[model samples]
Target: MNKKIHLKVNTDLNATGEVLSWFEQINQPPLSDKKIWWQCQTLLIEGFANIVEHAHKNLPLETPIELEVLRLNEYIEIRIWSFGQAFDLQQQLQTKPELTDNFQERGRGLKIMDSIAEELNYLPIDAHRHCLFLKIKY
Candidate 1:
């Protein structure tokens, strides 16, 4: 059996909670491995937060961010689409930022996502539309 879910959220930070709730609801039952589940959750949160904080930083809060999830037997795929300046995830990964002593703020989300996701891809659909795809294996 295959499962799919789609969510369109405002760019506001508060919308993260709603997006996460939808993620959890669809990732139940047949997808019962807790460790993998948490990894997916973390990736989802980090990815969305990245978009809100960096990608659409200058855009209006009313801007819509689209998220899609597809669950197959062996792996789950998540795609996030937003209107922003195009970014290259691969190039970002090539340069690792230094982690300072004060850990309260700045950096780390992308590193965690890179480690957890089996496959991660970023593409610019157009001048304004960019998409990030992540696949996690169960």
Candidate 2:
């Protein structure tokens, strides 16, 4: 089995900052490289933001989301697992969302994540659980 470092936090935006801080702490160079660091940070913050805004929006703050970061053979894997609503990333992408000039925002975050991460996926193993996996090559 691979050795993994696990961190769990409340479903709050503050937790996002905490997660980034954890990355900075353990990383060899402490997430100092601008391009690499921001890429990782953006993907994570967006995913975490999704959890906060969509998944746990109705749930009480005490309900936690589990974050697992593993340094595998050649890549780093970040898994955000929650016992919340089931979401499909592919289906979301296929959605033809209507956009207008005044819309201010649209499907930008997911697109950004898709572009940066080596692999980004949503796995709905069952009705009550959803896992978002974002992997980055080191």
Give the clash count for each candidate: 0, 0
Per residue, candidate 1 scores C-alpha lDDT tens digits across 13-96 of 898789988997667674677889889999899889888998999999999999999988888999999888887788887675
| TM-score, model 1 to reference | 0.91
Clash pairs of candidate 2? Answer: none
Quote each prediction's TM-score.
0.91, 0.81
lDDT values, one for every candidate? 0.86, 0.75
Model 1 misplaced stretches (Cα beyond 4 Å): 98-104
Model 2 spans with C-alpha error above 4 angstroms: 1-3, 29-33, 96-107
